[model samples]
Target: MFVLDANNPEALAECLKELNWLAADENIVTLTIPGAGNMNCVLRVDTGKRRFIIKQSRAYVEKYPQVAAPEERVVTEAAFYDKVREIPFLQGYMPRKIGVDVSNKLLAIEDLGPANDCTVLYNEGEQLSEETFTKLLEYLSGLHQQFMKNKVDDELENEEMRKLNHEHIFKYPFMVENGFDLDTIQEGLQSLALPFKNNSLLRQKVEVLGGLYLSKGKYLLHGDFYPGSWLQTEKGIKVIDPEFCFYGSREFDLAVFIAHLYLSGQKEDLIALVADKYEGFEQLNRSILNGFVGTEIMRRLIGLAQLPLEMNLERKKTLLDFASKLILNEKI
Candidate 1:
């Protein structure tokens, strides 16, 4: 298997040729890194005539090599695209699958030209409008409803990716010393770990949620549904990065989505509107959803995979307090 990067046009060109994407005379016009996903090496490749994305996953994380990952996760991502293609409402919201090379663990997909990820909302203090939020909820509703109470494709059941994500989302943030420098991200932020570490009740709740995350196989889920996975394009919101897709709690996706909205400083009513508009899943455990939301907030705020939020120390502490209450099933 040949490796390709932004600097290696020759390797990429050869790859395209092997995939039959490049004609005999055509060459790559430009190659650039697409986004901040940690799992894969995603590149935007532009030939003079057309553009597409080539994503390849390795045995370890592309962003953090020390963290081990399974190469087969890319195969699972490809399977997710295939399964969703049959669902009419979800077809338009996802990128078109062009080709997949299982032996090399690479995927060629249609490029959503000039679209930016929703992470920019947090990084730049932009807000998701009511209309856009509703659209997102609609997409999620369709996805959850389509597969609810049904047997998911065995090929799409991603246990390795879920275990990897489970560690990050459920276990790591509360650790006193996880080698992540919170002070570097923001001065004195390391002090915030005290409350989480000392609170036995909070840790117990997290353990319960983690158990459910691992054991429950209720509905098919886009396991890592967050701002980074959502793209804002001229056409509409496009969901990506289902490498962590699995059969898990339906509320897990919804909780993660709304947690980012809160962290991005969206209005209370807007957040409430999203919750009200969500018509997915026949049964939802509000307490469990709240626990997942709180855990997601904690992880993003202090875990290894950090977001570019513009919150000060005091505001972060406030959010942390709210997250704790939510996890404890207390009214906020």
Candidate 2:
């Protein structure tokens, strides 16, 4: 029931001290929000001795308070952080887990200083370098390969979190009347989106993919592996915010990553290279993978979770058209 309040540093410090995260000698200097906190209450806590990032998940999303989310989601992320403890490479790409307060639903981690997320890729003419993507894709490959199970286990099912994601990604976007106006996001978007949202066949395809997304799978996923989750730090492309993570289709993660690449206007070669570079790409179900990819593309363009994409209506229409075909299993 302990909520993180930025104005009340004293209470936050007291909470940290109680959890043995803030040492007795360390004094809280400042608490600043380091980045766009879409899901949880995140702050960079600077103590006299050291600095770290702390996240607290409440009953609702931090950015959209009306949207309800599981309060124990951060605890699930802590579990993911612990699961990856064995993989040094993955740990290198992610923040070091400092501590977790299960009762209070708080998590503290190493602060990758003054970093910006890959959302900047959404800017005009920006391209993700092959070098940066090597590390990023490698992390994805490793996570899937290392943690893949022969049989699905009950651990980190994260059912509540998955259902919350299910609504936004699959269900919310296509609804005829969701009460959100797309034109508010971008002029002519609603009109551009009308055909896709109204198409019964496309909706069925998206619905099938959504079912697949919710089904338990063998591989571990970053869960929200879009550009926003990939942070560009001084160290490298460090990934963060795995609060939406679950044991699901690896394709779902790759799909989201690739969808963003297309959404951002990254070149065709880079997209092709991504599929080739990932280990076990040859063995992955192409239908399911491409289905997920199309689903992601359609959702981002027409869905509730819109990105900061620098796109014209014509470009969006083109992407939406392509996404529908991909979902329909038509040739690229």
Candidate 3:
């Protein structure tokens, strides 16, 4: 087990020096842990005076300087953070960016607390009760409403982002490389009563949904709004991790939330619950919410957030069978 050594004050001080943090000498502590970070080192540095998280992308040498400029995802995310800063709901949700070191592709932002907490939604799983559901829905509704109202005309920019994000992240090659076998997934499906005829159907559904969604245009998306992306505190639920942030179909965010709900074992009456809660909100229609749900489920089943309903093989088969039936028979 990898324990985060928060006691390493010397190492924290050295990291501050290396990153050129302009703070007076004070007791500094390192509070980052080992986990699944896509392409950055997430660190929490706390001085006696202030606390902040340092997000630094590991540098890669340009083998051919003319071929490609080193990608700056940190820079991209920082810019995105500014774009969503005006959102009152997200003000507490996102960590405030305080400093940047573009040379190292590093950024510093406000630290939430304890540096990190294990209260992520996914980790909570089926234990998430009615209270948790209420909190999650509230957060989702606020975020979706904000994005739906945001008017922006930069479609081309979002298209470019789609290329970098969806195409690259959800591409077939990555799935194969990541040890996910299409054949095995298909076989698992076949064992179910409502098995998919071919794996191609998955891709087909994604393409259809993607095409329909593109026509709807970009809205602010918390690209990774799964349960793990949220925090419940005394104030309210705080959403975090804007690293995967982008401008795209608002449904993408909704889909991830729905997926979390499903994984949390709230799949039985999901449609009714979502409809009741979402349609009751101002400026939102049942059609729009249902449309979002349909597109989101299709996207998550085949896209980057390929979350399984159950981990056990037999249970997975049963869940897939039920899911297939729902997708085929249900209106949403």
What are the models' TM-scores?
0.94, 0.98, 0.69
Best by lDDT: 2
Per-residue alpha-carbon lDDT of candidate 3 for residues 209-324, written as tens digits (9 for 90 to 100): 44544544546666666655665555555666665655566655665566456555564665347555652344443344343444444334433344434345565444444444
Q: Give the TM-score of candidate 3.
A: 0.69
Give the Å shift of residue 82 in candidate 3.
2.4
lDDT of 3 at 293: 46
For model 2, give the 10-residue run with minimal summed lDDT.
22-31
TM-score of 1: 0.94
Q: What ranking of all candidate models by TM-score puts the best one first?
A: 2, 1, 3
lDDT score, candidate 3: 0.52
Which residue ranges in model 3 land beyond 4 Å of their true spot?
1-21, 34-36, 58-71, 115-125, 147-152, 155-161, 168-179, 182-202, 212-218, 233-236, 267-271, 279-310, 325-332
lDDT of model 1 at position 69: 94
lDDT of 1 by residue, 1-332 (tens): 87868999888898789778788798998999877768899999988799999999999999899999989888888888898999878978889888888988988888998888888788555888888888888888788878766554454567777788889888888887778878999998898767785788998899899888876575778888777888988888898888888877788889998899889999888987865788843368889989999998988887888888878899889999989889999988
Error of 2 at 9 (Å): 1.4
Where model 2 places Cα greater than 4 Å from the true spot, the runs are: none
Candidate 2, residues 208-312: lDDT per residue as tens digits? 999988899899999998888988888878998888888888989888888888998999988899867898988888888888888888889888888898889
Best by TM-score: 2
Error in Å for residue 297 of model 3:
6.0
